[model samples]
Each structure stands twice: as structure tokens, then as C-alpha cells.
Target: MMYKAFFNALTGAALLALAGAAAADDLVLEDAWLRAVPPVSPTMAGYFTLRNDGDQAVELIGAKTDIAGMAMLHDTETTDDGQARMVHLSGITLEPGDEATFAPGGKHLMLMKVDTIPEAGESVEICLTFRDREDLCGDFPVRREAP
Candidate 1:
């Protein structure tokens, strides 16, 4: 009886581990980093490329970080007058095998009212939430200069 219970528990654990692995394989985050801002600056920007490897589409709904009071998705657009303005986005969608890049002067994650200014070479934790996939949390490096 003891052997049977132990075997069942191990099997359950293995199944859960496999499920987690499969979930993680659905999405990939690459080259995540936070652009360094001045010590008294209230906002910073985070850039990354998110790739969806699954057969279905994924929607990046939002982002959050402990180091910021609020995080939001934004895009830079040119107006009729040729003035560049920042626009807020509700969410972004990615098709299968598609990669969405968040870069400076383009689409980016805006970190507002930062609690503390992160130093260069520091790693900050940011969580990206998707509509139908598991949240992706990564340690994004802080860079003093744009690459």
C-alpha cells in the first residue's frame, strides 16, 4: 500500500512538471532591458522582444514591476504636424511565430513613478501578462546607454 501511494505521488509530480515546461515553451522573451534615467527622473522605459512559439495567437495585456508605482504599454506615433507623441495602448497582439519588439522611440513598456532609480548593470524583475498564456517574468538589465 505504501509503495502504491508513493508511486502515484511521483507520477502526479512528473505530470505537473511537464505541464509547466510546456507552458514555458509557448512564449519566449529576449533582450529585455530597462533604459537608464536620471536619478530624479520619474519614468523609465523597458524594451524587449516577445516571440510566440505556440500555434495560437497571444495578446500581451499588461506589465508590472515592483520597482515602479505603475507600468503601462505605450507607442510613439507621428502626428499630422510631424510631432512625435506618446500614445497609450490597451494591449498588443502577436500571431504565432511572430515577434514583437519593444524599442526606444517605438513601442515600449513605460514605467511610471519609479520607486527608485535603478543603477546601470542592475537586474530588475518585470512581469508580462498575456491573455491566454502564462505570465512571463524576467530579470531585465538596466543600461545606462541605449544599445
Candidate 2:
């Protein structure tokens, strides 16, 4: 009975480990970084390229970080008067093998009311939520330029 219980437990642990690895393989974030700003700045921008490697689609619903009061997806667009403005994005969908780029003057992550400011060489944890899967988190390096 003891051997049976030990084998069952070991098998369960192995299955869980495999599941985690599979989930992580479903999505990938590359070149993620947050823009460096002055200490007094209230907002910061983050950029990254997200690729969907899963067999199904994934919709990015939102983002969250402890360093900021609120984290959200945003996009820059030219208004009817040709004035540049920033707008909030509800969500973005990516099909299998699709990728999305978040860069300056385009779709990006807007961290508002930053409570904890990370130094230029530091990094912060940012988690992005999806409609079809669990939240994916990564460390975004703070930098003056793209990495």
C-alpha cells in the first residue's frame, strides 16, 4: 500500500510539472521592457512582442503590476483633426502562430500612477491576462531604449 501511494504521488507531481511546461510553451514574450522616465513621472510605457504558439486563439484582456496603481493596454492614433492621442484598448486577439508588437507610437502597455519607480537597470514584474488562458508574467527591464 505504501509503495502504491508513493508511486501515485510521484506520478501526480510529474503530470503537474508537464502541464506547467506546456502552458508556458503556449505563449512567448520577447524583448519586453519598460521605458525609463524621471522620478516624478506618473506614467510609463512598456513594449514587447507577444507570440501565440498554442493551437487555439488567445485574447489579451488586461495587464497588472504592483509598481503601478493601474496597468492597461493602450494605442496611439491620429484623430480626425490630425492630432495624436492615446486611447485605451479593450482587448487584442492573436490566433495560433500570430504575433503582436507593442512599441512606441503604437499599441503598448500604459502603466499609470506609478507607485514604485524602478531604476533604469532594474526590472519589474508584469502580468498579462488572457481571455482563454491563465495569466502570463514576465520581468520587464527598465531601459531608455529598446532592448
Candidate 3:
């Protein structure tokens, strides 16, 4: 009887520890996800709304995705010649209350030279390199929809 009680207590303690670990690593991602594209599409994009809840400023430098070998921060702009082009972003700085958005036809994750087109309900991982901090891996699932 004593051994049974000890095992029950041990299980409860383990469950509590696991819950705490998950809570500690949780990040608040608002409107976070990937953009879906048609099959045989060579390139795609991703959009999100990011809010920095941490104390310090964060720089969004670069990203990596498995759908494509490279996931880069890109911005679209119209040139003097009336042409649109994408430029690689060095980084985006966010103040404590500031927010950054990745939207279609604007600032977004450029999935150039895609290797495999993700299914409509699959998930992709992005590794974002931050300035003066460790890289963050954010998971975004795929969903097909029009802009």
C-alpha cells in the first residue's frame, strides 16, 4: 500500500513539472501562420502579426524554412520605373509596444526557390535569427486561401 501511494505522488509531481516546462517556453504568436499556394507553384509567401512581450527590443533578422531551402525577410516596393521588386530585409526592430506584420504584397517571408510545396494542412518551421540573441524557431501551419 505504501509503494502504491509513493508511485501516485511521483506521477503527480512529474505531470506538474512537465506543465511548467511547457508554460515557460510558450511564446505569444498572434495571427501566425503560412500562406498557401497552388500546386506546382514555384514560390510562396507567409504572413503574421508579431508582438514582443519580452522586456528588451528584438530584431528579426533572417529565417529558414523547410518548404524552401531558404526563408528570407523580404519587402516589396514599386520602383521609379513602375516595376515591383523584393528586397532582403536586414532586420526589423520592435519596441516594447510596437508590432510588425508580414502580409501579402508587402513585407513578408519570401519563400523563394521552393523545393516542395507544402500541403494545404501541413506545418512548416521557420528559424529566425535575432540580433544579439539566439535564433527562434517558430512553427507555422499551411492553409490555402486567396489574398
Candidate 4:
């Protein structure tokens, strides 16, 4: 009888842990892709759609990738002269059901000091650091156009 009770408790605890883990991760990254740049290019741009599916708000602090010396968030802005320029973004916050789209002429991931630009038909992994949970990673396919 004691062994049976212990087994039940253990099973219950394991289930609870699994539920907690699922609840802890609330951010989903989709449509992740890297802009295919020239082989001699030292910088590249990565774009993706980030969605918050959980009830709570998620704050994205930064991004990192082994393929680049540094990865930073950026956005394109038009000046009074109608010229476009890239601005650095410190972070992004998304509420439940909110989706942030990183695309051309808009928010993007600027990967600088790349040792070797990944060719088209290849993929790279980029991890996003969040303030409320563990880092979330997604595979970004190298391409000339959005897919």
C-alpha cells in the first residue's frame, strides 16, 4: 500500500512539472529567415514573426547566434529627407496574442561581423533571450525572399 501511494505521488509530480514547463514557455517564433547576402558581405539581416501565445506578456531582450560575431535588433526609419536609415532597438515587448513581424523596411535582426555568410538553401540557428523565461531558439533559412 505504501509503495502504491508513493508511485501515485511521483506520477502526479511528474505531470505537474510537465505542465509547468509548458506554461513557462509562451513565445513562439515563426517564419524565421535570413537574408541571403553576398559571400563577401560582412553583415546580414534576419527576419521572423514572434508571437506571444501565453496569457502573460513576454519581453524580448536580445538575440545571439554562433554564426555571427554579434546580433542586434534593428528597425528601419525614414528621415525628413525621405531617406531610410536603420535604428538599433534595445528590446521588444509583446502582450498575449501579439505578433511582431520582422521584415524588410521594418524591424529586423542585424547580424554583424559575420565570419561567413550562410548561403541560400542553408539554415542557421538564432536564439532570443527573454526577460520572463528561458531563451527561445528557431532555425532561420537563408533565402532571397520571404517564405
lDDT of 4 by residue, 52-76 (tens): 9899888888899999999999999
Query: Which 10-residue span in candidate 2 carries the lowest summed lDDT?
Result: 78-87
Flag regions of model 3 displaced more than 4 Å. 1-27, 78-83
Pull out the clashing pairs in model 1.
none
lDDT of 3 by residue, 1-62 (tens): 89999999999999999975553343245565777888788887887777676656778888
> Candidate 1 vs candidate 3: which has greater TM-score?
1
> What RMSD, rounded to one decimal, does every model reach?
1.9, 2.0, 5.7, 2.1
Candidate 4 TM-score versus the reference: 0.88
Query: For model 2, what is the C-alpha lDDT against the true structure?
Result: 0.92
Model 2 clashes, total count: 0
The model with the greatest lDDT is 2
**Model 2, range 1-147, lDDT digits (tens) per residue?**
999999999999999999889889989998999999998899999999999998888999889999999999999997789888889999999999999999998899999999867889999999998986789999999998777
Write down the lDDT that model 3 would get.
0.76
TM-score of each: 0.88, 0.88, 0.71, 0.88
Candidate number with the higher TM-score (2 or 3): 2
- Each candidate's lDDT (Cα)? 0.91, 0.92, 0.76, 0.91
Q: What is the lDDT of candidate 4?
A: 0.91
- Indicate whether candidate 3 or candidate 4 has the larger lDDT: 4
Error of 2 at 143 (Å): 0.8
